[model samples]
Target: MLRFDDLQLFVRTAETGSLSAAARLLEISPAVASAALKRLEVQLDVRLFARSTRSLRLTAQGELFLEYARLALQNLEDGRQLLAGSKAGISGLLQLSAPSDFGRNTLLPWLDEFQQAHPQLHLRLLLGDRVSDLFREPVDIALRYGAPEDSSLVALPVAASNRRVLCAAPEYLARHGQPQSLSDLARHNCLLYMLGGRVHERWRFFDGKRELSQSVSGDRLSDDADVVRRWAVAGVGLVYKSWLDVAGDVRAGRLKVLLPEWRGEPTPLNLICAHRAQLSTPVNLLREFVQARCAELLAHAPWNA
Candidate 1:
């Protein structure tokens, strides 16, 4: 007889690629995870994993067994969903990942309201600028900006933000006169945000029928968007920032939008989740709530107007 607990541990370990990672996802010790796998292998009378100092690999038998284990776990989840649907109450820990600035300024407040509405649900929110691997991480859902390239996850569009504004403070603009054309940007100091091992210094602008790219240079760069925004507000240099982050400052006349008419492409925000055959009641409820909240907040935003 195979224990479901052992089966779940096996599936998680295979999905995450390490016993320690699986244990972290399951909120257990690595030793316990190793013991569970050992017991599972003993029950089946076959070695499941070929382990080394740096990596773990599945044996031929382990690969075949994993398929059946995934099916069994998914079936159990489907059964739980059916039972929960009849009761109409969502109860479980919902793990979420989102960017630091958006999570703090936008998503967290909405989550507070959601928690108040669903008192029984437990929510864990992880905030970071770097993208987390959903398959490896323990996150149940992620709020992602820009289009994700991973086809394994199910991405549902929740909201979208317009082209980011390239702006600086009035003081900075006074010192380094407004750029007359895209080529003129090379002369001015620009604050860049680094991502994917490159600093995004090229600003794209549109002039009705034609598009142009401006190559700008900056001595200061940071991965954190909030720090970049603060530097721009302090009159250090020009920055291309999202409206969601600088809308308040722009409205208050602290930060000014440069080349407002020549904006770049818009970015869509998505709620990405693992492509499981069945979703638990808690996951389904939180997904719906987040979708609604995102739509509401983006609709009434005053910056674009």
Candidate 2:
């Protein structure tokens, strides 16, 4: 078996073509470099170098071993760096995009805690309602609702059980009356949000064998989803939004879930990346952290009752 230091000395000696030169490069004495090469040759039972008074040269055996030696050293280096990174704690830039509402209210504070845990990590966040192009945009990851339409992208689920919820503030419910059934939504004002230049006017509900779908129109629409949530909280209109986005508001009694029996569409939250390779240690830790938060929110949801 080859010892690690011996292998390294052999490769350096072969590259430099002189034992003294390799020794100086490696910050070791020439005598030590000479002894290491001799020990290696004895182990292999092959004279790896031809020495003359004028010059040192590799024997035929040495030439063949050099390639394998270089590969082994490189692989060893890669493993060392990987272990070092793990030991050093997560460090480096984590650039991610998230929806306007969730980013502002939920992810922002969560990331603050995450950054505190790994102070070496630098975070760059972009918040919006528009779907960022992972390939075209300068974002390493994106937090999005619903599974990606592209089969090529890797969608790491943060909350598979999360769904859209139809909600309104107490004031709105008081003034317009709570919708008792799907048909009643037609008479009440619905707050709409737009993405990719089109308004999401369609609200869907699935209860047992019945699927109630409606094309809702409201007195207001906004390109920013957070603004739509704000409108709902202000009792401007009813809003259909992700449970995660509205969980805090519902918990605070700022919004009330309408039509609890008529379950809204499944809009599972996911961490989107261009591919599986994009899942680095920091990204994975972030996913685990966010997933835990989602689970906590779900556990307290009144709709579960």
Candidate 3:
């Protein structure tokens, strides 16, 4: 039943030793101050002040209440300050999900560097090909390829220009002749990967005029994209994968681009969250950090050369 304004007025009046003086300090009129003091006293059922026309003073009861009232206001202010500082500081658990190949091959070290830059930040990474449901899971952010199908989720571009590349190891190429044309892919062993319970055997490429579709098959196939990349790197078969995923291999001479004249499928990367509100300071920083790293790596892509 006690109001906060009345309590504040009581404390301010006790500090100033005059109701009218406290009213002026609080920018309130004399009548309102008197009413607030009366309300406080009535709620507490005790006389808070002994007033003379010339002066005002707190009763013993009022003196006791003043200490608790001051503590309450101070505690409220401290809570507000703590909340503001927490929002400004990037120091919390950031749970993220990303593709298997990119996570193992690239994101691990990038995140390590990112965490080093923010020593207070904690990370929980869930790396796999399976998509994390942001709305229903503990994940705070998800790194995904292609534009988001859900309009409700917020997607921030990390590598919008990134795309898949057809590549094979030199050892594999030495045994299986390199495909000279898109049509020749049928004759070569193309490492296949499964996504969403289906094999991604159909490879699409674009020349200047039209798209070239080729149905590829190989002796190897796996649901994990990282395995498919590894298969290509081990001279098992040719693999069509993201340029970012194969960039390091190409640079190390472990893999070589098969067809330079054709453009592979687009695999733009983005950071997705359930909603715009989830884009906190750490999430935004992660997005920017990954974006910069991807740009730095993609800059060295063999085809880019």
Compute each candidate's TM-score over C-alphas: 0.80, 0.72, 0.71
Which of candidates 1 and 2 is the stronger one according to TM-score? 1
TM-score of 2: 0.72
Decoy 3 TM-score against native: 0.71
Question: Candidate 2 or 3, higher lDDT?
Answer: 2
Residue by residue across 157-243, what tens digits does model 1's lDDT show? 766664567788999988888876667778888998865557887777775688888888887899877778888999999888766
Candidate 1: stretches off by over 4 Å: 15-17, 24-31, 42-46, 57-78, 85-88, 174-181, 251-254, 276-281, 300-304
Report model 1's TM-score to 2 decimal places: 0.80
Candidate 3's residue-wise lDDT over 18-49, tens digit each?
88877986799999999998888888899988
Model 1 alpha-carbon miss at residue 191, Å = 1.2
Candidate with maximal lDDT: 2
Give candidate 1's root-mean-square deviation (CA, Å): 3.5
Ranking by TM-score: 1, 2, 3
lDDT values, one for every candidate: 0.76, 0.84, 0.82
Clashing pairs in 3: none
Cα lDDT for residue 92, candidate 3 = 62
RMSD of each: 3.5, 14.0, 17.8
The 10-residue segment with the lowest total lDDT in model 2: 73-82
